[model samples]
Target: MKNYNLRSTDEHLNNLTSWLPNQTVSERLANTGFNIKYFEKLPSVINHCLPLLSALLERYDSRERCFIFNGIKCGFFLEDVYYCTGLPVDGVEVTGVVKSNNDEKEEICRMYLGVSGLLTKGKISLKNLRDRFINAEDTDYYTRAYLLYVIGSFIVPDKTGRSVDVMFLEQLKDIDKTGTFAWGAALLAHLHVELETASESSLAGHSYSLMIWAFLHIPKLLKLLPNTGRKGPDEFPLLVQWTNWLSLDLKNNFHKNLKSKFSDILDNLKDEDIVWQPYKNLQNLPNDHPQHRENFLCRTVLICYNEVVYHRPDLCPKQYGIDKPEYSGVRKEIAIYKKQRKLSGEIDWSKYTSEKGKVDYSKYIQEWKHRSESLLKEALGVEEHSGPTLSSTPSSIGNVRYDCSNTHFEDDEPEVEPLQPPPSEDATPRTQADASPKTPDDGHGSGGEEITWNTFYLAFSGQAHHSTG
Candidate 1:
């Protein structure tokens, strides 16, 4: 397999470090719910870690949508995005196309960059954006421009790697409302889409989250590097604690020994080797902090403008201390899902949701609403131990990895319902009311399949039949 290289605009991010010390800028960023204090240190803290990333990508199972490290399932989730970057997890879905007219685009260019018609070419140069805003006055314009830079450069960059998309300017127009966008969800969705095709020669999207997640969960991996000297539990948006943690020599050592060491660690990994709940006792966050919100259980389609990806938290039940289930039939379900995506073609999710009602996520919505019931008995404050112990051996059948390429689909597999647009913007949550019944009239009949947390775990544990189109 070819080694993948990470692509980011960290240089542009570094150039904007001058604004990090501006009190006004910091206040404005905090007001928007963004944690920019650690940003200045990113240039030094962020290294390619090519070998580590390449090894991880090599083990990524697209069908299961996570990496199988020594038989333990783990992947980036929305909560990770929130903890790592401190981006808001709930708010208006950051979707919809860039509808700014040429005049409006030029006006934004003129107002922000002191240059007219720069966006006529479709994007603004990162250098021009940085140079203009780096020393500009400490006002709303500066804050908006800085946010645009963060979005285009760090949050959801395009393939160019040297320019910021003018389209994001629409969301930044109202600086105060910027905090209301579900930035964390969008970042996670973008990263998920990137990971699906990561086997290629190059991988893009915010890889910092992936690196930090590995360090947080795998103690052995972090031991290979120099100590970060973090004295206590990290604050919310844990990325801040990682600043200036790696030295030049340490990075070189990683490039030299990362692959061999990483393999050895995973090869001999034990049940206790993984840190299942790193954030459970964060010193700065209260038990009821919004950072601990259960939105992580909401398995739904994460929409970032025209891009859409599935957020399947149910696959990694152990992350929540839940008992692993024995059987699952989601392999066929995911295969049919891919086939449906192909049949549907590219959908502008924002337009699709508005024109046809919201995509039917009722199945996962109902599951998320009752997440507490799925927790392990111990997690519910019971004294006696029940369910299987963490160290209990998994079924041997779960160890056999199926070749997705050889799997075939049959017509008897469960049928997924087509989209049914709602007539109005009703406030009701899309639960049972929006779901199609498994009746013969609905075409699925009584034998129609329903996916639950247990079934998803089957797919993750490699116990499900590996079949895809």
Candidate 2:
């Protein structure tokens, strides 16, 4: 590989032009005039490229020159753990089980002002993430997420040989090679940014990415606590059983494959103990246990999830092209449409509003109405130009012409398959999302929808939507 470390910042900046080489991020950011708002709080956004500048100017080595993720060094202070692990805190101690008085709403949002916009008297104020995405425009959050989904598939190869965990695909002997990237984290992160895009002509996905990162990380500063003798086998079996218990959640919220495999990983972990358990002694709790882990796991496992999102970005995945069977099975056009409507638009009804913000929310919004209205749209994954499905006679759901002609350009961030609850009326997958034939706008979705599901979003107003937010 060429020595990226040797280049100067000036040279690298110019080189980046060749890599990204466009104004996609800035253009889309203009859609919501988000640059102004984003800068209002974390003004450093304007100079995001500075880190690269510093690396180049200072002549950092080859490894440093690479875009390293947050988990590399992996250590932090106790105070930082709250945000890192997304635990709750009181003075200096960890307060578990969330401070929400309502039993239904487990706070897990963690980013951007820390409170939920979708609640009233608790009880999953909305339905789930798919609902959030379908109606995101009520809050206007889907702008960037949709774009990144497109870009991630466009730029990176789906099946990469690289992975964050060395053992991720090791046991699947039949599979020779995975992709060169870790897509799981990226998929999760992508869900977050798209949530920001739900608004009409709103902030850029990069801005949302940064915000979610703050929500998940800033407080605890993205620290992963030392493993307290948590075993995989113990936890895996329990997790598998719980996955079945949460079948409605898995089926409704994620893809069919995920739903099928939700219970499919058991045999893999049956022989391993370290792979199952997360804590040393299930009964014996650590005195310093971060409170958020309980709530975070609550939503995913049987435990409640936080209303606030954690920016544990180390878990965030980077871009890779979609060719690998694990993630990609279609082309750009169909991929783009799926992202715009099917993916980010889903609702996350697990949350309801409270003060401490479930799972530790971001200290954002500064106002209730704004957080409930505009900000909610930003988080739900709605978008502009949302309209009646272009036409009915387009043959397959993935064959119609889904247009984003006027959209601001942005690079793909990642794809996130959220953990959600399915619609009571959800129908069987009608058709596969068609891959664009080397054409960027070949509209389609793999197993795309034939009818609009009204997935749900920004239901804080407790009303049906007219169109895309």
Candidate 3:
């Protein structure tokens, strides 16, 4: 594997916690379903498992958009994002162009940041935001500023890593509606884009999600840490499950030890070594947990503003306890259609129909429409294997068992397979959020041409035999 380094946002995230809101504001945030109280307790510095990340990236098939672990298909899913970050999944999509003019932007800055001329070069410094809002008296403005800091520093940070774009102010303007945006989906979309370029040199955009996912799915990694006897509740937004759970070993040789142990686990990986459904027993998930969005998890496009990436949950049917179908990559035509849509000028997604939008994503729409049939087939006593096997692969790590003796995971709950809830009448996996409409002459208009599902299905029926792999 080629040498690669992770540009983690742990330091920024840890420092920003110092500005966490008081109980009143925290409660208010929780009411909005954007609780981030767990962040304040995160360790000052997180020692990421670099060796494991490197190995995973090495096996990442960018074209297929999943990691091929010993020929077994696996990748992060939308469900993983909801479980890991505790962010909402179902709501208005988090995609829109920043249409606020300079006067409007400055007005927002004055109200939230308590400064008139803070928008320097179209961005605000993290330090400036912290110093201004850390001790502000107005609870409303203080909460808004702190949220901006959290998003800029930790959630959707760019490569620069020190500043936040002013565009997010629009979302925070209506705090009550903040939770209405699918923050979890946006985070996953950004991370997917980062992973596509991870092979180059430096990694960015929420690497913690990937790290936690690895440890969760592959239990062997947890054996490297000494048990601290700390256990978080088994619930949604599962990252909270590890709050103050383990301390990082700062010794120089820690990486070397981690690398060695991870290699051993992979070498001896068995058919049952992976945890297909880690959140099977999670209790009392919020009403808006996006369980209905499961069908859209695969064969869909994830949109975070301009970042568009394909999600192929179809590649790993075992994760959902469904039988694996013949492997087929994303269709070339669908890929091209997504690319073309991305290049089209700023979209007025509010006017664009998600189910039957201007773009032709009928292939994905049909697959999602039939997702229930596949699950029903499995539920009817069809034989299902655990997953692909690695028994034929040679290994040098001798006699290692991939077990979870050192961790707090319990095996009491019968791993119940998750089924996609029946689709609603107007249910369509929303790929993007609603934005302000633009004029027809602005190059953003769809020229009054809309592709209905009937037309899309008719066009797609002829190409049904073409492989999507």
**How far out, in Å, is residue 73 in model 3?**
1.1
lDDT (Cα, tens digit) per residue for candidate 1, span 89-196: 556666543433557657766665456645524566666666777778747767767666665555654434455656566666677677777677767766655554
CA lDDT scores, all candidates in order: 0.47, 0.19, 0.48
Model 2 CA deviation exceeding 4 Å by range = 1-46, 50-203, 206-289, 295-469
Q: Can you write out model 2's per-residue Cα lDDT over 1-469, one digit (the tens) per residue?
A: 1111111110010111112212443344334221212112211111112112222112111111111221111111111222211122211110012222322232333121123444333222122322343334422233322222222221111111010110111211111111112122222222232222122221111121121122122222112112212222222112112222222221112222321231222112121211111222233223334322321111110011111122221111111000111212111111111222222121222232222222211121111111111110011111211111110001111111111111111213222333222212244421111111111222221122211101101000000001111
Candidate 3 on 1-469: residue-level lDDT in tens? 3343432322134544466677887788778876656666565544444566665655555444566655455778766666666665445555544332557667778865567666655566677888887888888788778787776566765444566666566667787767777566566666665555442334446655576777777787677655532333465555544433433332123444565566667655655889886776777566655453443334444555444445556556566665433322232213312211222222332232333342333333342233333221222222222222111111111000000111111112222223233223255421111211111121111122111000000000000000000
- What overall lDDT, based on C-alpha atoms, would model 2 receive against the true structure? 0.19
TM-score of 1: 0.67
Count of backbone clashes, every candidate in sequence: 2, 122, 4
Clashing pairs in 3: 83-238, 328-469, 329-468, 329-469
Order of quality (lDDT): 3, 1, 2
What lDDT score goes with residue 28 in model 2? Answer: 45
Worst 10 residues of 3 by lDDT: 453-462
- Candidate 1 regions off by >4 Å? 1-18, 40-45, 99-104, 107-115, 199-201, 226-233, 247-250, 253-255, 286-288, 324-349, 353-469
In candidate 1, what residue range of length 10 has the lowest lDDT sum?
A: 453-462
- Which model, 1 or 2, shows the larger lDDT? 1
TM-score of each: 0.67, 0.18, 0.67
Screening candidate 1 with a backbone cut-off below 3 angstroms (N, C-alpha, C), the clashing residue pairs are 357-421, 357-422
